[model samples]
Target: MSKKKLLVYGSIILSMLFWSFSFVWVKIVYLIYNPITTVLLRLIISSILLFIIGKGIKKLQPIKKKDRMQLLLLAFFEPFLYFMGESFGLQLVSSTLGAVIVSTIPLFSPIAAYIFYREKIGIMGLVGILISILGVSVIIFNKNLNLIASPTGIALMFLAVAAAVGYSVVLKNMAAKYNPITLISYQNLLGIALFLPWFFLFDFHDFIYAKPNIKVWIALLELAIFASSLAFILFTYGINHIGITKTNIFINAIPVFTAIFAYFVLDEILTFQKMAGIFIVICGLFLSQAKLNFFRK
Candidate 1:
């Protein structure tokens, strides 16, 4: 492979690693801060960091007036709704489980494309979707086929998945015009605007009164720098260099990273059922992206 290709892949992998660690970091932050406060503070820090980066690079393109509405909506789906779902969901479930659920974002993106843009899904993609659903069931259900985790948490994580798909759908329209950094910076800024009110109404008092320890502050800084700012930049660069589908394929690795980190860092159990489910989910993700003529060479 060419050097540029290698760089793109490396960036994507690093992005996933940062994101995987975010699951653990969120768990850490929740020990001291409520979900709303945690997300609000992270976005605040991230937005400022992104602004500095954008200014330093001299590539921060201004959005046209007509496109501002679409940009606002994009922010709503992502750093706003997506964070709301994932951060709160992590509060109730294991980080590993939350990562597993979030990994399914790519599985359904083709369907979202089909629905929103009239794109067609291959037969293999449909089959992969079914298999992935089965994998999800295996993860969620126990030996007795009863749900093993919090239903509300699973639902919230799915909400994050849906918001992610929506973000991609909208992003495809605007990416050609704006650079990745510009998009992320503006979206994060708008998301801060959207979430700050909720944070004040619900979480501001706790944030003001509670004395977070050093570790909590450290986790917050990592979330702002690595997960929210740098990771988004790398992931968006992947989407810009590659297409969204290919970039999304790399997202499947997040659960693996999260599982390992959660095991060591959070002492979360790596159960047989979870491992089996993760393997099946990854297989389905690969199959979903499989081409029709693979052996032609």
Candidate 2:
């Protein structure tokens, strides 16, 4: 593979590692702070880091007339609407169930891509998607799934995933006009601004009294610095370099990594069902990348 391919692929892997461990942190965060507070702190820290990185360069100026609607839409879905929906859903649904639902994102990305952009998924791509979803399902859900996660909450979470998929689909179109660092910085800032009213109205006072401990602070920083800012940049780079189908396969590893981290760090049990799920997902992930024609050499 060429240097560009190597860089993009490597970046995707690193982003996966960062995101993988974040699952553990997410649970830890919920223990102390409300989900909105946790999410807000993350966005705040992340926006600060991006701002620091882009200090010398001029920031993305006033949103362009043409781009304003699109940018607002991106912020609403990815950061504002998506986070609120997922966080609320977690309160109602099992985390495992939620993971299974979120993992479906990869399955859905291709469909979204195909319907909107006229992208085609070959036979291998379809197989990979199905296997990954099956694997995720096996790991996350067993006999006890309650379909009654408030219809509104469920709709919001699914919408969040859809919105993220939208971001991936449209990201390439905007990356050309602005610096990646500047663009992400502005995006996060925009998200922060969008949620400012919600934050103050709901979470501002809570975090003030919550006095998040050092562990909480560390976890939040990890969320902000690595997962939110750095990982997002890497994610965008990979998508731009490799296309969405290939870049999103990295999510296939999240279930396995999340389980392992939960086991070691959080002491979440690795039950037979969980193990089965991991095994299934890994198999699917491996299968997803098996393009035989590429290996004929």
Candidate 3:
């Protein structure tokens, strides 16, 4: 691979790593603040940080008038709707399971891409997605092949999955036009606006009364800086360089990373099944990226 390809892969992998850690971070934040409060504050902080960095580096582009609605939709699908589902869902599920569920984003993304953008993934890409999803299933299901997670949590996580697919479709069109900093700055800013009403009505009183400790504060800040700000920027960079379908395939790594993080940070158990599933996921990821002629459509 060329330097450019390596950079793109590195950015996507780093983004997945940050997001995997975010599962743990969100759990820590939930010890004090509710989901709405957590989402709102992180968006506020991330937006400010991104705006300042974007301005300082002279990388932020002015939003064109025609792009306003598209950007609005992007933010709505992502930091707003996605966070709503993910934060609440994580409260009801284990961090590893939550990440595994979210990792299914790539499974649905190709259908959305084909419908909206007519983007086609070869037969190998399809097989890779199924194999990765099966790997995710291995990590989530019991020996009896029954899922062990909360039904409500699973539904909410699927809501997040849908929102992410929508976000990817919209982002594909916009990534080419704007720098990642500008795109994500606007995304979080608009997300904050969208979340304000819910935050005020539901979480504001509780947020004011609750005092988080230094550790919780640190976790929240990490979420803002790494997961919301840097991760999205890197993810946007991937979409710009690699198209929506290929970029989203990297999401499967989140479960593998999250399982490792949860084991160390949250004291979650990592059984042999989980390790095997992780290996399968990595194999699928490599298969998806391979350029073998036999695997082409």
Query: Per-residue lDDT tens digits of candidate 1, residues 145-261?
Result: 899989999999999999999999998888877988899899989998999889889998888888899999999999999998989888888888887888999889989999999
The collision pairs in model 2 are 135-281, 139-277
**Model 2 lDDT vs. the true structure?**
0.71
- Report the lDDT of model 1 for residue 179: 86
Off by over 4 Å in 1: 292-297
Best by TM-score: 1
Roughly what TM-score does model 1 have, to 2 decimal places?
0.96
Candidate 1: residue 148 lDDT (0-100): 91
1-297 per-residue lDDT for model 2 (tens digits): 898888888899888888777666776788788888778789999988888777856654455789877767767766777687777766665444455456556766766776777766555656766776666555434467633345565565567677777776667566656556766787888888887888789888877888678888888888888878888888877877777778887877666676677778977767787677667656665565555432111
After best superposition, candidate 3 residue 10: deviation in angstroms? 2.2
User: Residue 168: error of model 1 in Å?
Assistant: 0.4
RMSD to the hidden true structure, all candidates: 2.7, 4.3, 2.6
Please give the clash total of every predicted structure, in order.
Answer: 0, 2, 0
Among all windows of 10 consecutive residues in model 1, the one with the lowest summed lDDT is: 288-297
TM-score of each: 0.96, 0.83, 0.90
